[model samples]
Target: MSRKVIGIVMNGVTGRMGYRQHLVRSILAIREQGGLPLADGRTLWPEPILVGRNAHKLKEIAEQHGLEHWTTSLDEALAHPLAEIYFDAQVTTAREHAIRAAIAAGKHVYTEKPTAETLDSALELARLARDAGVCNGAVQDKLFLPGLLKLKRLVDSGFFGRILSVRGEFGYWVFEGDWQAAQRPSWNYRTQDGGGMILDMFPHWRYVLDNLIAPVQSVYAHTATHIPERVDEQGRTYPATADDAAYGIFELAGGVTAQINSSWAVRVDRDELVEFQIDGTHGSAVAGLRNCRFQHRAATPKPVWNPDLPATESFRSQWQQVPDNGEFDNGFKVQWELFLHHVASGTAYHWDLLEGAKGVQLAELGLRSAAEGRRLDVPELTL
Candidate 1:
């Protein structure tokens, strides 16, 4: 019976994740579905202003979508009549300035990860938002993932009773495109552009663990870049300065140790990549991005750790695929809907800016520990 129009000013909306995930899959998708359903038979529709620096490109996008609101100036967009929320998908290095400006303008925020470049800076942003008394959040998209959500279900249901440890293997060959077209963005391979595996992925893992598995207490890590050079679009070769691979071991608050292997160098092999192997004292589960299965030993398997002897037999065949829990949409859309709801009704969403900052903190410490060659204690933030 009532409609609340939450205006969202989205910065850096023309970039890859900004365009595909936030704009198309999340916002426009919500609009296409006639806005999100409300509890009392109402609906909330977001009035989104696409903000970017390129005038021609912004006009092209607006024309393509028949969107009336598009602007080249961030300040002008923020000053627009209907803009209420400020969303940023800008590069990590650019996050702090944009966020400060947004907070000063008295708008709520939702943005991509590595919320700021370092732990201290990220925490500051969180505090600033709180001081300004605005509902602040960051994109923790992994928690909305269907497979990971199923894994969380199994963990919550005591199916994996007394969890032991977690192992994550996430990678695919990201070609430098010297011989062919490059598979990933050139910024992802350059440190100066705020790119690296430790920064990029450990944030995702930190939240995933806290949400589904456990809270990380300490971390030890080492980072490497196997391929040190890449050719860009302009046929210029740049020395790779970011870590292409990261191996990290995290001890959870409950003492469950997790080893996460993230790489841009490894070739894809499995049905869909990004698998997590979660083991409990009574059972073990392996989850791919799209599929998850588990095996309950019912007891314990009697096996000796002998390299010479034949490895355990028929272990893989015992596990069964877990059925999908419910109808799922795009993970990004799930987060978007939750955010819109929070904006409308003030409902609590677990993955707020602080949680996102924790993710950034873990990443900051992971890389620091790698450089220092020692396990680092993660400090808790009050804000």
Candidate 2:
């Protein structure tokens, strides 16, 4: 079988998510597995040319992975004839310019979202890619999660007939950098550096709700900065100007409603860091990152509200676990492979730059809704 090696200009590998998920788990894992097989008895292999700001860190990463190509210059990396794809896992602020440059260089673009800091910029990127006739995509990794996959299966099978409402809880306490090192980077809490819970997470919520449930019609949100000050990496305290917590109620098409609360200040009390419970006419399901539990209308228990009576029913045990019918791969890796296939063989991919732009739009509107303290309608995006 013939083997095709596609060079990918991988930007922002020094960061945590970039380093661990995209670099090691997805791309390198594909290389380790002898490449992805194609329909024509061929193999599609990825050659990642590391690109980042820090030469020392890039060199260290390259050597650790036994890779040859490494460069700090985007122009130089894009100039390489073998580099057909440009992948960006950089911060939100740096993404738009890099993607624009990639589009100008006639390279297929794939990036972690929010694709741009604003809706206009995101749409501009989409328009540029379309005009350039280059393939583009944004990372929507949550859809491929095992729990979400099972939840999707139930949705597709009409398990939750005539879906009514969904409740989602997603967050964990990010240690304010004084007592202990924060799990996330400091930039995540800074507004000037493209930080905030709304900008960071509304994009994810957009795609998840749009794909899994229904299109979001309107949003009513309230946001706050629960933590006023936090220590930085260098042990200096800085004002946390960005909102750390956001409570949103989304009105979906067909009268479906979804209420999701995202916060970095809250401690976990559920089965997973992120979970969504979907309730419908026929049954209800609660899905986490890897597991989904369901309770049918017939099996659902009835309990009367009594302030004096002690609770006896084991409510948690009423729901049955959804069995893993098949092996589940890494969500990021799966999307990477799909995008690779799309680039290689002209495969139909719906999650393009336009889709990414929609996500940006959602975030913009969500922030506006929070500011106004009123519901805002989600307008349909074109081009």
Candidate 3:
């Protein structure tokens, strides 16, 4: 069988999402599996060179993974003739510069969401990638989650006839560091560091709504900094300037209404850390990170509302579980494989830098809506 080795420059993977999801879970997993198979009787193997500012950490990670390349000099990595793709999972604030450098170096670009801190910059990056004639992509990992995949299947199969509304609940209690230690990085609590619920998550909501249900036409949102202060990783306290919670209402194309609540201060009461419930005229389904449950219109139970009486019906069990018809791979890994195929074989990929810019646009609009306390129409973005 023919084989192609594609060298990738992996940056900012020393961070949480970068380290776990992109580097270890995705690229490394792909390498472990003997690379991705192709339609033309060929296998595309990835040769990833870890790039980060921390020399010691990079060396440690490379050694741990039995990887041969790790470097502190991004320019040096970019200069490598074998490196054709530059992947960034850096902090949101640092993404634009690194990506621009990679593009200038004529490398295909792929990165984690919210392509840039602002919509303008995000658009500029998209323009640059197109001008340079390089294949580019942005991470929309949520689309590949098993639950969301099943939800998409149901939607495609017309099970949810005339989808009416969608409700998304995301987040869980994040430790304040003073007591149990904060679960997230301290940079996430500082706005200057590109930390905030609206900026971080609205991009995700944008893509999810646009692809799964419908394109978001408008947004009305309320955002808050519920926790004003938190302890840092170094055992120091700092003011939390970013919004810890965001409650948003999105109007989608085809008149579907979607409401989503994202908060780090809230406690979890659902089956997963994130869940989406879609209601339609014919059926209703709730999908979590890994599972989906549904109740058809014919099977939905009717109960009389009695505030004075204790309800004895098993409401939770009334919905039937959506069976797992096939084994699912890690979401991040799946996207990586698709991207590799796109790079190797010129396959059609919909999630480009322009799509990433759309996500940034939504976040910007959401913040504006929250600040003005009004609904805002989302203008269509074009190349």
lDDT of 3 by residue, 99-132 (tens): 9999999999999988999999999999999999
Worst 10 residues of 1 by lDDT: 296-305
Per residue, candidate 1 scores C-alpha lDDT tens digits across 53-102 of 89888888888987889988889888888988999998888888988999
Model 2 agreement with the true structure over 267-348: per-residue lDDT tens digits: 9999999999999999999999999999999999998898898999999999999999999999999999999999999999
**Candidate 3: C-alpha RMSD after superposition:** 0.8
Model 1 RMSD in angstroms: 1.9
Which lDDT value does model 2 have at 80?
A: 87
lDDT for predicted candidate 3 compared with the true structure:
0.94
**Candidate 1: where are CA atoms >4 Å away?**
299-314
Candidate 3 residue pairs in backbone clash: 177-181
**TM-score of candidate 3 versus the correct structure, residues matched by position:** 0.99
Q: What is the lDDT of residue 109 in candidate 2?
A: 97
State the displacement of the C-alpha of residue 239, model 3, in Å, after optimal TM-score superposition.
0.3
Full ranking by lDDT: 2, 3, 1
The order by descending TM-score is 2, 3, 1
